[model samples]
Every structure is written in C-alpha cells, then in structure tokens.
Target: MRQDKPELRNLSEPVRFKRALALLLMTLVLPGSAQIVAGSKKAGRYAWRVIAGLVAIVVFLVLLSLVWRSGTINLIVSPTTLRIVQVLLILLAVGWAALFVDAYRLGRPLTLERNHRLTASILDGVLVVLVMTVLIWSSTIVSAQRDFVASVFGNGEKSKADKGRYNVLLLGGDSGANRIGVRPDSLTLASIDAETGRTVLIGLPRNMAKVPFPAGTEMAKQFPNGFEWDGCGHDCYLNGVYTWAMGHKQHFPGVKEPGLVATQQAVEGLTGLKVNYYVLIDIAGFQHLLDAVGGITVDVGKKVPIGGIGGPIKGYIKPGKDQHLDGYHAMWFARSRAGASDYERMTRQKCVMTAMLNQLSPQKVLTKFQGIASASKEVVQTNIPSGELGTFTDLALDSKKLPVSSFSPVPPLIKTGDPDFELIRAKVAEAVGKSEALDKGSDDGDGKKSGTPSSVSPTKKPSTPGKTPSKPSTDVDDVAQVCKA
Candidate 1:
C-alpha cells in the first residue's frame, strides 16, 4: 500500500475542519471552484465551460422573450425542444452532484475530525439532493406543459390575419348528455387588431334567422340564398348551424370539424369578416376554467337563479355590488334562464367573459398555470395553432389595460326573427372602424370614449361626463364601463 499523505497526518483538527468547510462553501456557490483551488484543474475547466454555457443560454432567452415572444413560446410548446431540455436537465443534475462530491474529495475528508467530517458529508449530500430534485421537478412541469399544448391546440390549421386583423368566433357549445350533436347556444365574434389587440365584440343572437354564407363556399352552394332550409322553414336560426352541419359532414369534405367549419362560414358571411379561428367552449366544463384562475368578480345586477333552466330553482346568486363568484356559481350565473330572458343571459355571459379577461394577470397565470392548462384542455376546442399562442398571449396581456368595445344585434337595433344581413354587416363594419379610430385617438391622446354602439353616434355624449351612467349595461359601448363596475 502507498504511504499516507504527510499533509493529512500533520494538519491540526481546527485547520482541517476550516479547510473542509471552505471547500464545501465555495463549491456550493460555484461548482468545481474548490477543485480549481486544490484538486483537478481539468474537471474545473469543464465546469467553468458549463457555467458559461448556462449563462449564455439565460441571456439569450431573456433577449428572445423581449424581442421575439412568439418564437420563445414556440420553443416552450414544442415537444422536441422540451424533450431536449429534459435530457439536459438530467445531465446537469448528475454533473452538478458529481462536482459536489468532487469538491468534498478535494477537502481531503480523511484528515478531518470525526464530527467535522460528518457535518461536511451531511451538507454536501443535502445540497446535491436539493438541487437535483428541483431540476427534476422543473423537467416534470415542462413535460406537463407539452402534453397540455398537444391536447388542447392539436394540429389545427393556422390562419392568416385578414386586412391586418383576426376575427375569431367564440361559441358556447351546449351538448347535453343525451343530445346527438352540439348546438351553439351563444355566439360572439371577437374581431381583434393584429398589432394593437384592441377588440370589437359583435354578439349574434342564437335565434337570428336567414344568415348568409360566402359566395363560393359549400354552405353557400348548398343554400345559395343564405342559411335557409325547408326543414325549419326559414325558422332555421343561427344556432342550428352546428347541429345541421354535424348531421351532414359529408358535404364538407376535407373538413376535420364540419359543424365548426360551417358555423365559421356562417359567422364570416353574416359579419363580412374573415374568420381566422374559432374557439368552441364546452359549457359544462366552463366551471373548471373559472375556478382555476381563483374565481372572478362581477357586478350582479339582479338575483341570478341557479339550477333552474329545466328544473326548480335550487338557490340564488343574490344581487350585490362587486360579488366574487366561484366556478359553480359563475357557470350558473352565465347559464341560468329562470327569471331572465335569453338576451339577458347573453349579456351576462359577455360580462363574465369581459371580467375574466380584465382580471386575469400574468402572475396569476404563472402561479396557477398547471390548473389552468388542465382545465383549458378539457373545456376548449379551437382552430388556433400552438405557434400563435405566444403572440396571442402577449396581446392578451396588452388588452388587460385597454377597454373592450361591444355591439349586439338585439332589439332597438334589428329584428332577430328576420335579421337584415346587409344592415348587420354594415353595422359590423362601422363598429370595427370606430374601434380602430378609438385606438388611433388613444395613441394621439385625442380619443377617450370606446367604440360607440350602432344607435349612438360618436358626437353624442353617453352620459354626463362626471357621473357614471346607471344603465351602461343596456348600451354596452365600453364593456369595461359596465363589467368593471
């Protein structure tokens, strides 16, 4: 056997203990640091390279997120990128743990006093376990995010912005447990500015009759005069488009979801705006999403009935100022049709949507991302691609500060029994144009009012400038005006 090292045999207990603690501390702060000071320069060089690479990666990501947010999001959602990151994290854990072990070795543990040696061993072991566990946990979350994106967005067709705007159709899909096909109970077209994220919400009543379709599309060819059919005898309302299309998907070949596609066409034709994407929300699963963001605060104008659409009223979400509602109550608040008319329910639904958008923050999303993503995967089906998620994500953040403008083709404006498609389209165009002007005015510090309703001219005053209007809910010029209060 080789002779024992002379330094180890000669060192005092205090000196040895002090040296051991110093090595462990330095290694904990900067891996391979202890080795460079005392042991293998070769291993230390490798660690320094790793540290440099990690620093470079962090800097690059920071810049990327700032300059090209969508690219950053694409990487995060890409399964390939996530898988590579997972492997790298595993390697990093092992290499980092090895450095700690090596740092402890450089301390020459054999020379330490029994108590001091035990203490150093314990600390080094704890650090290794802690660091490894954290990285592994992070890797697991990355996996979860990947799965969530895959399940929710799927491989939907990407749509281009039309006239520098994105028109997305939002439908509240009502598919009963016993129903054959889903019916779109609620309909709203969200026409968003591609660059500014300023939005115009155009609400279409479910009972709107004889909606037109695009000129060359299958829906138009099938019903050239508009969305008309003898089966319902022109009583073929807008909501029935989904059920009708689902029962006849054969006509819509190459379409993954004929019901959704047909509905998109109808909305596009009726509004004269190109539909870029469609989000079909399952009504029953909506509660889970509301709960994930820790509930929302809404002004309940009247007593909202619960469990009364087809049965006895179980309870009431009492009217109050600034009421905070949980998932269950919020869902019922949007769905209940007991004492309220369908149009009233539609307005309430819009209010709920506006409140959620205004209140949901990046901090909340980050903290509750796992829950939100899980609920979203179940609650939503959409044609929005995963690639544009980052762009929309940024837009959503920008929208939180701005107001949302809305228009609904309801009475005092148009007849739902026999809608004026041409007039409706004109109103839609006017609403969008005024919203754009509103955005421009805000930029030039000239515009303060939101998009005016079709009935209200921009020159006309909404209410007294100083006082809040009591019935802002009826006009719905600035959705934030009513929903926020």
Candidate 2:
C-alpha cells in the first residue's frame, strides 16, 4: 500500500520552504535521491536505477579514453556516436526537467503560502532552465563538430610515423582568379616527433629550382632530371610543380589530386624524408583562421607590403612591436614578396605558424569554436585521417611548451636558383641532429635519459631583414626567439 508523507505536508511555512530548497538541491545532485527519502519508493527506485546506469556509463567512458586514446577519439568523431549523444542529450534534458518538476511536487509546494510558492517555484524554474540550456548548448557544439569532421576529414587509411616522426608536407596554395589550379607559394616539411611533438620546420624556398621527384613514381619518369622542363618558362621552379602536375594529370591515372601527389613526392625526394600526409591551405582563405583566433601578435621587423607584389602598393604592415594583424594583413604578411626576399617572407610565415600553434588553446577553441570550425572547412585541406586527431591533438599541446627549430636553404648555404641536392639533404640531417640533441638534453634534465627521445610562442623578436639567426652556414634554433619582437 502507498502512504503519503504527512510530516512533509504538515510542515510550517518556513520549514516547507526550507524543505523545498533541500529537495531541489538533492534532485539537482542525484535525481532520485530526494524521491527515495520522501516520495514513492517504487518511482524513486526506478529513477535511481536510471541515474546509476548513467553514472556507470560516464565512468566507463572516462576509463576507456584513458586506456585507448585513439579509440575514444575515433568514437568522438564517429557520426553514429555523435547522433546517439545528441539524441540522448535531448531525452535527458526532457527527463531531467520532468524530474525537477516531480521534485517540486514532492516538496508539497501547493500547501505553502502564495509568496512561499513563488520563491520555491522560481528556484525550481531556474535550475530547470540552466540544465536545459547547458545540455542544448552542448548538443549544438557536438552537431558543429560532426559537421566539421564530415566536411573536412575523410575516412582515409591512417598513416604511421616513419622512424618515430611524421613528416607532413604543408603547402600554402595561391589559387586566385588568374591562377590555373592551385600553385604553391610556400612549401615546408613539418617533421614532428610522434611522442613528444618536437617539430623541425624545413622551409623550401619558392624559387628553389630543380625539385626532385621520388624514384619509380610517374613524375620521376616524366621530369627525368628534376622539376625543370624547359618549355614551361618560370613555372619550372619547385612552387610551380603543382600546376605542371595538374596540366599533365594523364600521367597520374586514378589520382584525384595529381598536383598534390606530385608536390608530396617532390618534397620527399628533396628532404629524404618520407611524406606521410599533405595539408594544403589556400593563402587567401588563411585570413579567416587568424581572424577566428582574434588575430595574432607579431614583431614586424620590416615593412611588409600589401597588394603590391606586381601592382601599385596600397598599404604596408609597418614595423612595430606587438603588431596585431587581422586576417587580411596576416595573409599579406605571410605571402607578401614585394620589397622582401622569398626567404624573408618564409621566416615571417614561420613566425605566424609558431604563434598560431602556441597561442591557440582548448578554452579559446571552445569559446570561438564556431568561427574556427567554419574557417577550417574553408581554408584547410588535408589527407590526414580523422581517427588520428587525438594523437596529434595531444602532440600539439605538448609542442607548445618546446622551442621550434627550422632549416631553410637560402643564400650563403645552398642558393635557391641552383640548390645542391646532396648539400640540402646533409643540412637537413644536421638540423634534425641538433633537434635530437636538444631532446636528449631535455630528457636528461627531466630524469628520463634512457629513452630515445625526439621533439612555439607569439611575439618574442624579429630578426633583422626578417632573417632568422640562420646564417647560410648555420641552422636556426627557436624561431620564436628569432621573431618575437
């Protein structure tokens, strides 16, 4: 037989009001706890079971994520998981809101005086609104994540690290109305340690002539000597390989992006580092990413021209300390070649990359998630499997704490016009060797010298002429120091 809690109903106005708040807090913390203590045991036990099941599920997920990081990451990106979570959030919000109302009923609100009813009613209402608002907001963010993942990342095969490092070819594309396909203006091989996320930014000068193609690839057979076909005029340089490959797509049968494939192979051939993946970001769209992050602060060592590469000079990102560049000027700052050497611009680009990588945080991403996600869909294109996002995300967080090293074949070292392939490879090996040494030093200091180890900030100095302390004869270490103004 069911019986009412006469004591609860017979309470004085002050006591009833206090009981109402206590019941509400109990419901907020554990949905069925208040019911078990004061309301129907049958109903409370059922709700208790449901709440217990939910708690167990959450605990299991947390444990799984800690044990199998990649699997948890894959689950997060999976459409099925996202949709299920979305549906569950809606259902939970509805059910929990109902539970709060039931808790109000259990509080015996109607028996209280009018003013007391108003106060308790208002408290219950606020709790319900807060829960619903937060859950709905969460669902919206999850939906955004689903859309972003679906649009940007394909279910491609995962790539493994080569000798404990991922060598990704990052190409800055200049696909304007006047351009044919996407021709690269900046080429860099980002060699990152799989464990520590230590990176070496190997900058390939845009004017670097005679870029090599990997052996046995169709491009190798086509160009025989290098990426230097005589009839193409100035398009024979490394940056022009994309357009040339696009034009000769017939040679790369079944390839969706022959240009990208050719450029990857060329980088592999030049650096002697196997290219695992390629990220092509259209420089024109690069502005949105910066804008999304509220722009980056840089030390402008020299005047960077805007819209005057081969036309009339419209403006200049004048020399200054702590210069904040919006998307528009940031784009020009990275791509501007007017009154600046190609190498100088590459140095500036490095500074920007370092800044973006370090300054971006999980909190910032969450706050400006919509803008960043929208920008990424438009500006970034890559073959990296979405499943590996967790691994890379972890690495990026780790990388923020370390200094970034760079190697560029400029004057006094290997001239861009006639780069010595052997010398370029040798210098690459030396720079990588230095990074390895740095890893060893760090490990020794941190008390883990046994393991074979591998592995950016905004606005710290800008080297003169945008020249990183990189002498043609010497490698540059910690680009942030070189560019922090």
Candidate 3:
C-alpha cells in the first residue's frame, strides 16, 4: 500500500505543474485571480477590489474629461492632486508586487519538480517586474507634471486673447558664462488665431533699438520716447532690454520677472499685439533637447560657420539638400552670424522649428520619452499656466494641419536701428490679415483663390502691366516647403 501511495503522488506531478502554470497566467491577466482560485481567498479578494476600484476611477476621470474638459484639466494640474496621485502610484506598485509574489507562493511552486519550480520562479519574477514597471512609470509622470507646474506657472494675472488671437512671445537666447546676461538674440511673436489655429511667425531683429514700451507702464515712463533714454549706451539694443531691466530691477516695483515683463511689454508695444505669454529657451539647453530627440534634419541652403566671434571657430555646416544635424551643429546652424545676416539666421531658425515639428513623429517621441522629458525640463521656461496645457495641446494639433507663414520686420520692411512703429504695426496687421484671408478662402473652398496669399510670400515680385514677372522671394515662406529635407 505504501509503495502504491508513493507512485500515485509521483504520477500527480504533471497535474501540479499544469495547475501552477494556469494560476500564473490567471494572475497575469487579472490581478488576484490566481490567489482566489488556489491561494489565500481573503488576500485575493482585497487585491481584486483595489484593481476594480482603480479601473472605475480611471473610467470616471475619462468621463469627467469628456464632460468638463477645463475642470478636468484644472483638477489634473492641481499640485495637491498630483502629489496624492504620486504617493498612490508608489503604494499601488508595492501592493501589486506583493500580490504577484503571494500568488506564486500560493501556487506551491516549491512542491513542483525542479524544472517546474525554476520555470514558475522565472514567470513570477517577470510578472512582478512588469507590474512594478508600469506603476513606477505612472508615478514618475505625475511627479514630472507637479514639477513642471511649480516651475513654469505663476499666480499673477493671466492675460486674455485680443481679437480672437493669442500672441505669444518666443525668445531664444544665451546665458553662457562668456556672455553678459540673458540676451534675447532671436525674438519672434507667434500670433495664433483662437478659432482656426492659423499662425503667423513675426520675427524681430535682435539689433532693433528704440523699442517702445506699452503706455502707462513703468518702463514706458522711463523710456517715453523709446528705450534710448539717457545713461543707455550702444547696449540699448532690443536684445539688451532683458539685461538692462535685470540690472535695474528696483525700477519695476512688485514685478517678479522684471526682465521678462519688460520684454513682453516691449513686444506688445512693438507689434501692436497683446502678448499673452512668453517662453524663454536657453540656447545651450535647446541643443541638449535636440540631441535628446536624436537630432533633426534640415536643408542648409548655405555654408554656415560654427563657433566664432571671440570664441575659436569650430567648423562649418556645409550646404546640403537634406542635412542631418546633431545638437551642436544645429545650434550653430541657427545661431551662426559670421558671414550671414541675423535675418538669414532667423529664417534658418524657423526652418529648424518646422523640421522638428514635421519630423519628430509620435513613434520617435515614445522611444526617446525619458531623455526628451529630462531635456525639456532643463530647456524650456514659460509663464504659460499648466492648467492651460490641454487647450494649447489641442490648438497645436489643429495648427499642424494649417500652413505656417512668417514675416520679418527687417531691412526693406522696417529699419532695425530706428523702426517706424506705425509701419511695423501696419505690416503686422497686413501679415495677419493675409493669413486670416487664406484661412477663410480655404474654409470657403474657393479653389482658385484658396491658395496661400501671393502677398504673404516675401519672395513674390510685383507683376508688370504688360507681362507677369517672376515672383520675388521674401523672408516669409511656407514652413513645410522650407523645412523639407
């Protein structure tokens, strides 16, 4: 009888192995399922309830987003909510890992044959890793959001859109150790239509001086005529406004970011457009961000010198049809002003922006998510509130489908040393009007006239009465065509 019992138990080894595999698979598919079927029913029930509750909460949030978009955004961006969620995610990860290990123990993996026991252990390890990985990732994202909101947003008064348009000031500059202070070398105002997402990039020269400030502001009072007030020297250029303001921060009482505030006021006064927000990009950090995204492809129309002007000359980005540039080269490509004019550099910068917008596809972003996120945090500093991110994200998606046009208030258009503010305003209005007209024509489906406005192309030449002349090219260009690699 004893010999028969030993044989029976040995014969059931295969059955035990099959049961263990089944429980592991069940746990993988549905947390706590395996324990309920073969392990501690109490522990399994608790875990299952938690899992179901989480799913329900997620569904609720989704429904809330659909019903109340703004409210949902505000709730999600709330700092308190983010911290709580982060803690919850960490707890969930620990709990899920424990449940996975408990499930393996409940399977009685130790009782199985040596091979089966090893297999079970490996499976259990994989399950724990996957579960913990997901939870940890979620926690990380929540923490990032919290940091982003805290760092970039302000409690100050928010500006409203004017005439259904939001004009955002995008400043690209350097704060290198070799440099003085924050000099906004590249200044552009992105004027976006609220309804259609139609956008126009208005580029201003860094050497532009005699910049005016909005009336009634402290800066305006000081520089009523222009920024060329007494005590200001050759450094009174538009780019130096930030540095000047920072040096005299006490002049602008109660202003937290005096330099940015002063710059925003100047932009508004210069373009005759209400500047809602400003985004400052550190040139060095910008290069890091480009590298994080695996570099970008651009069409280099000319040989651009790299590293010059006091610093040792590095090299040159040779002219090419489709040039792939790493961060260092791309930075120099957009910033190099040795042989090329700042206006030309502005065009190249726009091309870089367009290339990134078109080429950095969703798949690439996912693959380089962590690196991109880390670099972006270091690179971008904006006053745009986190609560408004969702709205802007949607707008960005809409803008992607539309054509991007640019206008440079340089040279023939407007003198940099002493700009005609009235003419500058008129030119800005004209450019915006042309963009709006094009959008309207497209919406109305006027096939013959639906194309981009001829006047918007800076390259277009005036047609003669007797014959049609070749269109002259201007600084303004179709971003897509210009960015083609």
Better of 1 and 2 by lDDT: 2
Q: Candidate 2 — what's its lDDT?
A: 0.80
Give a tens-digit lDDT track for model 1, residues 1-485: 44446886687888888888888788878888888987888888899999999899888988999998777877766777778887888888889888888878777787777898899899889988998998887777777777777888766778888876888899998777876767888899998887788887888888888888999988888889877767785347899888888888899887767989889999988888999998999888899999999998887777878987677999999877788999999998878878767777776777788988988887898778888889998889887888888778777777777678877777757787777878888877777777777555534344433343433333223433222222223233776654553
> How close to the true structure is residue 230 of candidate 1, measured as C-alpha lDDT?
70
Tell me how candidate 1 scores on lDDT.
0.79
RMSD per candidate (Å) reads 4.1, 4.3, 5.6
Please state the error at residue 118 of candidate 1 in Å.
3.7
Query: Compared with the true structure, what per-residue lDDT tens digits does model 3 show for residues 1-485?
Result: 11323433565778877777777788778888888876678888998898899899889889998776556767877888989999999998898788778777766676799999999899889988998999899888788767766766655456677877888899997888988777888888998887677788888888888999888988898889989966666688888888888889899888776889889888888988899889899887788989989898877766778888777778888876668999889888878878667777877777777677667876886567667767878878888876676556556656877877777788766778878989888777777767777555534454322234534533323222221111112345555555553
Q: What does the lDDT read for residue 377 in candidate 1?
A: 88
Candidates 1 and 3, the one with greater lDDT: 1
* Candidate number with greatest TM-score: 2
lDDT of 2 by residue, 200-243 (tens): 89988878888888889888998889988657667988888888
- The clash count for each model shown is 0, 5, 7
RMSD of 3: 5.6
| Candidate 2 backbone clash number | 5
Could you tell me which residue pairs clash in candidate 2? Answer: 198-455, 460-484, 461-483, 461-484, 461-485
